[model samples]
Target: MSAFESIPHFDDSRAAAGQQARVEDTRIAAQQFRQHMLNGPKVRYFESFDLITVPYPVRYGLRNAFSRERFVEYMHIQNRLFVVQFDTPDGLKTLLVSPSDHERNIETPFFRRLQDRTAAWLTKLIIKRQSSVPQILERIGLRPEDVDYITYDHLHTQDVRRWLGTDKTPGLLPNATLLVHWREWESAKDLNPYQADWYCPGGIAGIPESKVIGFDGSIMLGDGVALMHTPGHTEGNHSIVVHTDEGLWVTSENGVSVDAYAPLLSTASGVADYAKMIGTEVIINGNTLENAVDQYISMVQEATVAGPSRRDPRFPNVFPSSEMTPFWMFPGTRPAFYVGHARHGTLQRP
Candidate 1:
């Protein structure tokens, strides 16, 4: 059986209709109340283990509207980001999840003086033409005063200052760690042009290399939850996996969206080179490891270059096939699913 067959088909229309028809159920209200205490007040959040449905505005072309669906559709499939408050025993931690480094405006004087002109130039350009991070926060119903931690899957502009330890926000958590991919923290500046500010003074001082956690394949965070390295999008791309009484549910960060992945081959190929190198060195260690590594790399390169024309034979009936399909299919279509058991582990309602 393929990965696609192993998962259930998420009915978007049924869900949309159900949400549309939902009366103010007292159960929902009670659950929201509990979530409010857990996540904290002034928390306006959205979650999608699948595709993110909110249409956040993007800059460029006539398509640059501040609509959610438009943004979702534009990205090809749903990519989720959350404006949430992560509450711990110590206190409430407010964070904007998954803020892209290349998607924020950076006007700091320190960044303007960077030595790497190419990266610096690109940073400025991305900032000039990108969506405003503050605006995104507002759209997601988050208030500046309510924010404490800006957690990110990878280094994005909003998370950069925190990562670099140069953020001047008053009463900000002094010891809050900027969780990021260890590989990106080590080599992103050279590989990704958007990371120029990360290497600068204001940026560099705050983000010490010591704060990073380099785990093989996955790492456990908070309770029993784990973050798995799924790779493919960027070298260190990962998905958040929560093991609840409901079984195992994985949040496809930049991995394959549920809708897209439903039809096996519709899944976008991840980074072939990294996958091969890591898989060979780690997962597939054996006598034929060398050949397996070479074959894996070659297969990834071929699939990548072949684009949509290359289809995995397992599931051939999927439509709108293309290797380079955009991230979201429709804005707000990829709502995050809360997977948990009905009896023991329930998804905390918002």
Candidate 2:
């Protein structure tokens, strides 16, 4: 038997000490993360939000999901998995967005084979130890049970069945429910042939129906949060809108960088200007299976829903949700902005 499996009891002093160290380490990590969110450099690509925060996986510190030439105009970017928490009457309602593929075991034949052919830049981004969602949660002081709902902008390269469990196995988050758009959920179930390589095979297959909650259109999840349909990249693509002290911050892969969303203000002015001159607004092509017209429309929706850009010169409150970058680059290191004071939008009491 393995040494871990052979442990007879849970009360061993060494084990207890290890547990304590883990918790303590996690607490320290959380504190540092809070600082990073507050103090990280406010890249033009990101608009600062006072209410919403990135509570876990401070930085993946890897390159863009897209390759070298895919986004040639851009220099480098990093992918970030954000644990966005919102304050609500029901208590702290947590939403886990863009949770990356944490179940990819590097030791497996699949990873081994892929790694042999994988580019050097992607190697650091897909490290197995850091990619496991369960370990990530533990490191961030979040009990999987604490997650009320989990969803992604789309179903690209996801393996959520592991999180939701099957008929025989239990899900990692016992109390959590997956909130997915109906179209997106269906698209995942019936992946297109051309997009086969982009999605996780059987990502959502065989999950208990009770664990999935499908929404038809835009649904408000109480206390300054809402899910809105923004399809263009994929038929089921959507973005999460959070009302923060700085205004609305959206989470999506539709626009890879702030420049994609706001071309006029981006560094790629020559190209952005040319596109606008011709009536086409340039946005990052998230999923190849997309409609340019639809993508333009979706980007408009995101801009419209987002709160007004700030006037402060130090850091304007507007940015792309995640920074997608190539290797040899790191994510923003600014400290957390919204400490404990997240001014959520409220409704008129009838």
Tell me, by lDDT, which candidate is best: 2
Q: 257 in model 2: Cα distance from truth in Å?
A: 0.5
Give per-residue lDDT, candidate 1, residue 25. Answer: 31
TM-score of each: 0.39, 0.64
Q: Give model 2's TM-score versus the native structure.
A: 0.64
lDDT of each structure?
0.32, 0.51
Residue 228's lDDT in candidate 2: 64
RMSD for each model, in Å, please?
A: 16.5, 17.3
Name the lDDT value of residue 342 in candidate 2.
Answer: 27
In model 1, the runs with Cα more than 4 Å from the true position are: 1-79, 83-96, 100-151, 156-159, 162-164, 167-175, 192-216, 244-247, 264-350
